[model samples]
Target: MKQFGAKIQSFFNSRLGFFVLAIALFWGKTYWAYQTKFNLGVAGSMQDFLLALNPIPTTLLLFGIALYMNGRKSYITMLIIDAITTTWLFANILYYREFSDFLTFTLIKGSGAVSNNLSKGILGILNPTDFLVFADVILLILLLSFKVIRMDIRPIKKRFAIGVSLLAALLFGANLSMAYSDRSGLLTRTFDNNYIVKYLGLNAYTVVDGVKTAKNSAVKANAKASDINSVLSYLNKNRTTPSVTYSGVAKGKNVFVIHLESLQQFIIDFKWDGQEVTPNLNKLYHDQNTLSFDNFYNQVGQGKTADAEMMLENSLFGLPEGSAMVTDGTSNTFQAVPAILDEQGYTTAAFHGDVPSFWNRDNTYKSWGYDYYFSKEYFSSGKNYDVGYGLKDKIFLKDSAKYIEQLPQPFYAKLITVTNHYPYTLDKANTSIKQTDTGDDTVDGYVQTAKYLDQAIGELMTWLKTSGLDKNSMLVLYGDHYGISGNHKKAVAKLLGEKTFNDFDNAQFQKVPFMIHMPGLKGGINHTYGGEIDVMPTLLNLLGVKNTGTVQFGSDLLAPNRNQTVAFRNGDFVTPTYTKVGSRYYMTQTGKEIEKLTAAQKEAVNQATNRVTTELSLSDKVITGDLLRFYKPSWFKPVDKKDYSYKLSNGLKQLKEAQEKKKTSVLMKNDGKSLADEYKTDAPELKTSEAESASSSESAAADESSSSSSRSSSSSAAK
Candidate 1:
């Protein structure tokens, strides 16, 4: 036993042994992360074997560089490399916990905008097991410090070190070849980041993403005005004329886009333990005055909510790699909804209870031509009022009424809620509904937060009615993205009462709630298959705006001949008749896999597949090449980002000045009285001094209302 122990120590003290140890530790840690942290969907023995073996080539390639150095330096260099790589792994782990996707260079470059908002979220999603990623680094450092693994100062031969690196290269080549064999067009036709990481390892995946990003940048640099011709031709060919019945139905009305954070379609009418998960939303969805879509999926990429926003506003798909809003938002030209509405003599503003920099909205909203932005600084925020992503939903919606009322009439406003975001955590006092017993905290708490959001929405709706804004405004409410990701399939399966969950189920799970509500409008649940990309065109049609000759990928949903194919970001697509997930096709009606497709089915799938590919590719080209810079429509005016400023004082002053001079605001029209008093909530956080202050403010406003009315009457008489 003594002799064996001495031999083991001696071997570890050698240069060769140390290199091998580092490779083994890195490979093991990466494999563990793959199996535990990521939902790579590794099925079959071949995939399992490839996933385990894929880490080796990259590990060898990275650690092999240390072989060229002399003993102690080589050991230190290998440890440093290990620490860096482990940190990268740890970052992805944290990112994947929320996004369910890998990191890209674009996201890294744009991190500065969102980093401040992520601190609390990062701490919330962290697991004790995540620390194990650094276990190898800690072990190596401790061993070196204790002198348990003595350093050999001998220099390795140059030829031998070169040979080691060459061996790593050869192994990587083999790995790539095998990966290609298993999955054809693995790199060129890459669909999901998961496939890249699953087949080529995370390190290799990062390299691929970096390469693609660089390629995209190069493409943009070389792009010309004529490059938009093809995109224009495609859109024109597929453009669907707006329905006469629905077009101009809500024209000249105020537009209020309510962005529901992380609310999925399943929760719309979902019942848990005899309790409706979203009773308020369900009521609105089924209301005769609301047009709801039952088959609206959120097609977001790694950018998630930001991606959804990009699609919703621009009628453009997000980049397949990262969030275009973060990566290209500052520089890219957009004919976004806000800009369009602004051109139509409407004041455009956005309200959010989070930091201006979160999702890079502060910069992106400007590019979108929003005249004013009311962000976290505009709201009352503190520990009690703020939760996961920003201010509690109830508080955010209640406070937003002040600003919403201040906006000029016939305005376009987007209110982004944040309390129902991921890591769905709500204090016990705020949680009025029962949570699901899914044995997963994320899944269980998701219900609670979603219910809270619904309640908040209900309060906001009531305020809108009492304030009389509902009569003139058209409300567009949509779930931003999926709240419970596929990572919690077990809990989801339990909650859904499914014996088993499959990829088809996951594809179907991406459906989100989309509704348009207005008074005395033709409305019902419309079974149109659409996505966020369709929002801009659909809304524009209803506003009596013609999208002809514009470069939009989506057609109006109200168009009788509108294409029903809903393309997901990852190359998968769903339609009314068929749903394709990865390499498999399933019948949309039955959710059964189609192993033996008939000739008609095959043709249908092929046509849909081509359309999906074309749309995604064209959208990518438009964004990556900034094609909008070249394609200016006669009716559309390019937005000068300089015209926008989201500073709290400046925004409030501008709104106030506009109201005083023009009396164009809803509040000004209502006799210079604020309608914030009409908003009520059962929020526990507001049940104290905050509530009292609100009451006092309401009373003060009431007491001064008669005087304000007299002043208004005198001004009107003078005019």
Candidate 2:
């Protein structure tokens, strides 16, 4: 036993042995993360084998670089390489825990905005097993420091080191060949990030992402004004006219968009434990003044919430690989909803409980021509008030009422909620619903957060009505994306009482609630098949805003003869007759896979597939090329991003100035009085003292109303 131990130690002390050890450690950590930490959906033995084998080439290539050096430097380089890769792996683990997706180059580049208030969340996401990601690094450092693995100072021929790198390249080629055989169009058609990581490992996935990002940047730089011509032609051909019945229905009305984070449509009236999960949303969805769509889907890519927002604002699809908001938002010109409304004499503002940099909204909102932005810096915060991604939904809505009241009348306001985001966690005091018995913490906690969001929405509705804002406002509430990912299929199946779940079910699970509520407006459930891309057009049509000559990819959903094909960010699409999940086709009504397609079904699928491909390609061209910079609409003026400032003091000053000028605002219309006291919430974190203070302030304002009016009159006269 002693002789064998000595032999092992001697081999590890050799140069080649050290290189092999580094590869093995990196390979082991990556596979471990794949199996346990990430939900890559490794199904068959082929995928399992690929997952194990995929790491070898990348590991060899990385550690092989160290072989070029001689002596202790080689050993140190190998260790440093190992440490860096391990750090990246650990970072992805933390990111995947929240986003249910892998990190992209775009996300990393934009990390500065998201890093604020991230430490507390990171601590919560950490698992004891996560330490294993760095276990090999620590072990290796200790071994080298203790001289257990002595460095070999032998000089190797330069040819030998070059051969090692060449061999790595050859192995990577073979790996790619095998991956293509298993999953056709793996690189060309990257429908999901998990596919890349699953087949080529994390290192290769990063390479692919980096290459794609570079190509996109190059494409944007070399793009021409004529590049928008093809896109304009496509839009002109596919554009649908607005419905005469619904057009001008909400003209000149204030627009209030409520972004419901991670709230899926399945929970609209879903009963769990014999209780309604979203009672308030269900009621509002069924209200006579609400136009709700049951067939609405979210077409987000890696960008998720930001993608949905992009679609809602510009009627465009997000990039296939990363968030356009993060990558192109600052530089790209957009004919967004805010700017479109701003041209029509409407004040545009966005209220988010998160930091301005999150999703790059700080720069993106300015690019979109928002006159005011109320971010986390503008909101009051405490331990109880903040949770998950940002401020609690109830607290966010409750605090936003003050700003909402100060916004000019007929304003375009967007309030983005963040409590129901992924890794949905809520304090027991805030939860009013029972958790599900699915045994998946993520799925179980989803209902509680969703319920809390519903309560917040209910409170906002009550306050809007009490302040008479509801009388002249169009309230649009929409779920941003899916709460539970396809990874939790079994838990979702159990929750839905389904006997079995498959790809068809997973595709169907993408549905999210979209409702537009306006008092005395003709409203009912519209079964038009559409996605987030259609939101801007639909709303603009209803508001009597003409989108003629605009470069929008989506048609008005209320149009009588509008095509009802909904294209996902991925190449997959859903139509009224057919649903495509990957290469397979399924009947939309029956959810049965078509083993042998009929002649009619084949044609339908082919046409829909072609359209989806063409639309996605054109949209990608528009974004990656920043084509909007050239295609200036006659009715629109491009936003000068420098004109906007989201600072709290600046926004407050603007509001104050507007009030002094007697510009119409909710508060100004109410005789220079705030309606903050009208807002009511059952959130446990809201202290009674706070409520009393608000009431006291309202009372004091009432007492000084005459003097305040005189002072306002004097100020207006002076101005």
Q: What are the lDDT scores of the predictions, listed in order?
A: 0.86, 0.86
- Prediction 2 global C-alpha lDDT: 0.86
True-vs-predicted CA distance for residue 218, candidate 2, Å: 2.0
TM-scores, each model vs. reference: 0.69, 0.70
> Lowest summed-lDDT stretch of 10 residues in model 1?
111-120
Off by over 4 Å in 1: 1-217, 691-719
What lDDT tens digits, residue by residue, belong to model 2 across residues 171-284? 999989989999887876554567888899999999987897787668887999989999888888888988889888999999999999999989999887778988989999
lDDT of 1 by residue, 650-678 (tens): 68888888778767887898898777887
